[model samples]
Target: MGGVDVVYNPYDRAVNDDPYPVYARMRTEAPLYHNADLGFWALSRHADVSAALTDSALLSSDHGPLLDPGASGPHARTFLSFVAMDPPEHTRMRAAISRAFTPRRVAALEPMIRQIARDHIEPAVERGTFDFARDIAAKVPLDVISELMGVPPAERAGVRRRSDALLRYDPAGQMSDEGVKGILSLGDYYRSIVVERRAAPRDDLVSALVADGELTEDDLVAFLFLLIGAGAETTTHLLCGAWYWAWRNPVQRAAAFGGAIGAWVEESLRYDTPAAGVARRLTRDTEWYGTTVPKDARVWILIASANRDETVFPDPDVYDLGRDTGKAISFGAGRHYCLGGPLARLEGRVVLEELTACVAPDYDIDRSLIRRTVHGNVRGMVSLPTTVKPA
Candidate 1:
C-alpha cells in the first residue's frame, strides 16, 4: 500500500475470489481510485462511498447499477426497471412497489421463509452431506421470492435455473449468449403471469401490480426480473458467504450457532456482501480529493470496500459477530436503497436459525468441492459441500 498503484477490474476472476486485499490497498492509497482501461472510477473509503450513494442528484442510477457494458445508457430501464430510473419516476415506481415490502408484510413472511428454509435443510440433514450453497442457500431464497411473486410450485425449478443463467457473465464482463436467452425467457414468462393476473387477480405481488395499473406490462416484467432475480441471487450469495466465513472462523461459528443469529447475519452482510458495489453515472462534474470528475462518467461506490474501511471498522478484516455493524452499507443508502433489505435480512436470519437448529453446530465444509462464481457486480460461492450431523 505504498503508492496509488492499485489496479482493480471487477471482471477479473482472480480479484473477485479475494478482493478484500485489493480493496484495502485502495482505501489506504487511493480512496478515489480510477481505472482508465476499464473506464470507471471507484470510491473505496466509507465516507466517500456513503456520500456518493446518498448524493443521487450528483451520482445518478439512470444508466443502471451494474458494470455490464450492454446494459447501459438510456435503455437500461428495460432490464433494471425502477432500479435504473431517477428522481420522480424512480420515486413513483419505488413507492408503488414498496407497499408490498413494508415492515409488516416482511415480518409476516418470516413463517413462510422459515418453513421454506427448513424444507430445504431437512433434506440436507437427511443426506448428511449436501452442497449448502446450491442445495439450500440457492433454493430457499428463490422459493421465497417465487412464492411472493405467485410463481407456482410446479414451475419454480425452471424459474430458478433460468434466473441463475441470467447472472452468468463471460470473460468480457457482458452477459453470455445463454444469459441473454435466460433473461428473454424470464421476460416472456413474467409477461404471461401479468396476463393471467389481469384475467383473474390473486393475493400476490404480480396480481397487485396488475391491479395498481401503475406500470406497463413491460415495466412489470422488468421489475419482476429485478425483484425476483436480484433479491434471490443476492441472498443466495449472502447465505453461502456466511457459511464459508463461519467455517473459516470457528470461534465465530460457535457464536453463530449459539443464538447470535442476528449479529451473525449483520456481520456477514458487511463481511461478504453479495453485490459488491453499484455503479452510478455522474450527472455533472464533481470535485473530489483535488480532482474534478467529468460528467457522464461511471463511478462505482464500493460497498464491500466501504464496509471494510479501516477508518470505519477497526480490524476490518476480522469476521467478528460482536462487532457493531450499524454503519454497514451492504444494503446501500438514500432513495435507491434496496427495496428488499428487510426481506433479505429476514431470509438470512431465518435460514441460519433453521440450519443451526436442524444441523449440528460443528458441521464442516469440504473446501475442495466448493465452487465460486465471479460476476462483474456480485461475488459468492456456487457450491459449498457441507457435512452435517443432525441436531
Candidate 2:
C-alpha cells in the first residue's frame, strides 16, 4: 500500500469513518510518522505504541496529552487531576480511589447497572424504532457516573449536557474561547457539588473522598470532572462501537448472543477502540523506529492502528471474538491504564447482552443509516437506527 499523509485533522468526518486505510499506509511506510501540520509525532506500530504508553520517563501524559496547543488556560490548569500527573502523585491519587473502582465494586453494581439499562431500553424496545445512541448508549454511562457521584437523578441530564460541551474540541484548531468558558463552568458546578457533598456526607465516591480528606473540595470536584469526562464518553463510544460492529456482522452477533458475549465485547474494543489515540509529551529525546523524536516533542500513539497491526493481530482487519490477544491496549496500559475499565466493560456487557436478548430476535439494524460521531479521539455511532418487530 502506498503511504498516506499522517497530518490529517482528527475532527474531519471522513477521517473518523475510515482512518484505517490511512493508518495502514502509515504503518507500512512511516511507522513513526511525524505530522508537521499537527506538530506531533505519531506511532502506528504495536510495539512503538506499547513502548510509548509504558515509558513514563520518556513520555509524559501531563500538560495536555492530546496535542492541544490551545488548552493553556487557567481553568485547564486548575482542573488537572491525577490523569495528567506522573509517578508518586499519580500513584497516591489513584490509590485513594482504587478501592471504589475495583472489579468487585463494579461487579457489585451489576444489578443496579442492569436495572438502569433495562429501564432505558424497555421503553425503546416497545417503540420499534428509536435512536440507539441517544436513547440507549448515551444514558448508561451518564446515569452510572451520576449515581456514583450522588448527583441527583433529576440533574444528570444537565450534567451530561455540560460534560458533552466541556469535552468538545475543534478538529480545525484549538478550542474556542467559549469552549474554554464552558469547561470552567462545568468545573465550578462540580466544585459547588463537592462542597455540598462535604457538608452532608453521603455514601458516594465524592463524599468519601471529601470525608477522608484525601481530596479537598477543589480536588473532589476536579476528580469528579475527570471521572465524568474520562469515564462517560469512552463508554458511550464502546456501546456505539459494539452496536456498529454487531450490525455489520450478524453471524458473529448471533454467536455472541449465544453465550460468550463478554469475549465479543472485548473483541469489539480491540477492533474499534473508543479511545483511538493518546498523546504524550516526550520528556527526553528518544529513538522510535530509528527516528529521533526530540525532547518536548508530542507523540500521538494511535491505539486503533496498533490494535490492527497485522504483525500483532492475525487477520487484523477481520473481527474475531475468540481471538485471545492477551489484553488489548483498548483500556490502555501501564500506570495510566483506565481505572474505570471494569465498570465500562461490565456496562457494555450488560447493555449489549440485554439488548441482544431483547431486540436481536426482533430487529434488523440499518447499517447504512448509522451515523458516526465526527471525532478522532472517539470512534462511535452518533445515531444507530433499527426496525423492530412488534411484541
Candidate 3:
C-alpha cells in the first residue's frame, strides 16, 4: 500500500478505536511517515523509534510529549515539568525526584497497593458481574497514586474526574475547554498539597518534595501533575487492556491464573501499550529512510507500533505469553524512560495476582459494552463489562 496514501491521523475516531491495523500499514508502507497538514513526522519501525527516544541530542522533549497543540513551546515547562526539560535540567530534576521516589519507597508501597487491589477486586468478584474498566482497572491505580501523593481519600474521586477531563480532546482534536480547566484545577490542587505539606509535613511524596527544597513551587506542582497524569492514567489503561486481552486469550489467562502472571503482565504491556506514542521536537534536520525531517518539527515515536514491529517481534499480532518482549519500547527509552515504570509494573502484577486468585479462571467480557477511550495519545477501554464465577 506504499503507492496509496497512508493516513496515520491520531485524531480520527476510527483510528483511535483500533490503531493497530493503521500502525501495521504505516510500518510496512512508510516506516518514516510524514503528514504535511498535521505538521509532524512519525517513526513506526522499532529501531527508528527506539533510537529516536534515546537520541536526545536530535529529538528534544522540551516541547512536551503530548500531541496537544496548546501544551508545547515555552508553556510546556509550567505544566509538563521535567518531562519537557532536556540534559542538565532534566538530569537534575529527575535525580531529586528519584531520590524521593526510590525503589525502596515503591517496595514499601506494595502492601498498601495490594490491599487497595483487594479492596476493589473483591467487591467486583463478589458481585460476580462488573465493569472491569470502571470497577477495578481504574480505581486501584488512581487510588494507589493518590495515596502515594497523600491526597485525602474523600477528594480522590474529584481528582479522578479532573484527570478524565484533562485527557479528553475536543472535536477539533485540541484540548477541550474542560481539559484546560482540568489542568488548572489539578495544578491548583497540587499546589494546595504543597502548601499544606510546608505547614504540616506528612509521610508522603508531597512532604518529601517540600523537605527537599530542590524543586520550586511550580516545579513541584508540575511534577505532581505529571505523576497523576502520566503515571496513574497509563497504569489504569494498562490494567484495562490486560483484563480485556486476558479474556480474549483464555489460555494465557489460565496460564496467568496458573502462576505465569508476570509474563502475562509484560506481554499485555507489549501487546497493547497504553501511551500509543510520545511527541518530540526535532532539534536538527534529520535523515531517516530517505526522508529528511526538518528542525523544530514535531516527531511521534510510535511506541505501540514499535512494540508490534514484526522485525522485532515475531508474529507481532498474536498475544503469546511466552514471547520475549524485552525489546519493547512500551515505557520508552533512555533519559525519558517512564520514571513510574516499576511502580506501574508492581501495581499491574499485584492487582492481577489478587484478581486471579479470588476469581474463577473463566470470565466473560461483554463485547457490546466495551467503550474505547477517545484521546489521541492514550488508547484503551473506558468501560469493559465482565461477568465471572467465584473460584
Candidate 4:
C-alpha cells in the first residue's frame, strides 16, 4: 500500500458513501493492494480491474468472497446461482436464458416498458410532490419485471418485499438474519411456482425455465433469484444515478431532457454504477502490477473506481454527459458482461424519457434529502423526494 492508505473493510459506511477518492488514491498509490484483514487483494486501476474481470483462468468467480461473510456456509450452498458458476455450467445456464434476453426480445418490451413508466410517473406527476425513488423509479421496474416473469400483478408486492429483504446488507458486511430467512422463503415460493408452471406452462420466464428440462428445480430457483435480485436492484440504482446527476448539474439535466438523455444514463452508469465492485477468487497463482496473488486468494474488482480512473477518463470527477470515452466498466467486460444490460438500458431510457417529457424542466429535486443504501455491493438511493409540474 505504498501510494495509498489501505482500508480492509469494504463495507464501512464512510467508504460506501463515497469510495472514489479512496479508489483514486489507491489507483495512484497502490494499484494492487492486499488487505490482510479482509483477506482479499484489491484491483483499483482501470487496466488491472479490466484484466482481472476478463482473466477467468486467474481471477475466477466460481467460489470467491461472499458479500456477507456471516451467511457464508448456508448462503454458499444456496446461493450457487449462475453468477457464481464458471464456464461450461455457466455457459449452459446462460444459454438457457439467452433466447429470452436477446436484443429483439428486450427491445420488443420498450413500448410496454414506456407504458409502465408512464403509468407510474403520470400519477406522481399529477400529485406534483412525491418520493421520486419510491414513487417513480422503484415501482416501474418491479411491475415490468413481474410482467416479464409472469408473477401475477397481485403477488408483485410480496415478491418485491422478499427480494429487497434478501438483498439487504448492512455497512458491517452482515445480512439481516431475517433477510436470509426471507431469501429461503423466496426460493421456496419460486419452487412452488415452478411446480405449478410445470403442470401448465405459460409465456413467462418461469414457464420458459420449467419447459427447459435441462434445468433442475434448484437451478431454476437460483436463476430466478439472480433475476429478481440483480434485475430489479441494478435498475433501481440507475434511476437513482440519473436523478443524482440531474440534481447536481441542472444544465446537464436540461441537455438530458432535450433528447440526449441516453448519454446521461450511460454517464450515470459509469459515474455511479449500481454494483460498485464484484468479487472473484484466484484459481491459479498470478502476478499483476508487480504483486503476486497466490492461488485461492480472493480479489475485489473495483468497477466504480475503474470508471473514474484518471489515466482512463479526463477530469474523472466531473460528470460530462457528452464525453464518450466508450471504456466504462459499468456493465463489466469479457465473459461475465451483464446479460441484462439491454434490458437495464431500455428501462433507464424509458424512465428518463417519460419523466422529462411530462415533468417541468426545472423540477424541484432535493439532493440533500436524498438517501442511499448503506450496503457496499449495491449503491442506490433509498429515497428521493422531488416536485414536478403535471403535464
Best by lDDT: 1
Give the distance in Å from residue 287's predicted Cα in candidate 4 to where it truly belongs: 2.6
lDDT of 3: 0.86
Error of 4 at 269 (Å): 0.6
lDDT of 4 by residue, 231-264 (tens): 8888988998887787788888878888888898
* Candidate 1 clash pair list: none
The superposed Cα distance between candidate 1 and the true structure at residue 211, in angstroms, equals: 2.2
Per-prediction backbone clash count: 0, 0, 0, 1
CA lDDT of each candidate?
0.87, 0.77, 0.86, 0.80
TM-score of each: 0.96, 0.93, 0.96, 0.94
Residue range with the least summed lDDT across 10 consecutive positions in model 2: 71-80
State, as a TM-score between 0 and 1, how close model 4 is to the true structure.
0.94
Candidate 1 vs candidate 4, TM-score winner: 1
Between the candidate structures 1 and 2, which one is better when assessed by lDDT?
1
Question: What value does the lDDT take at residue 180 in candidate 2?
Answer: 60
List, residue by residue over 51-140, the lDDT tens digit for candidate 1.
999999999999998876665677878867898999899988898888777898889898899889988888889999888988999899
Better of 2 and 3 by TM-score: 3
Better of 1 and 2 by TM-score: 1
For candidate 4, what is the lDDT?
0.80
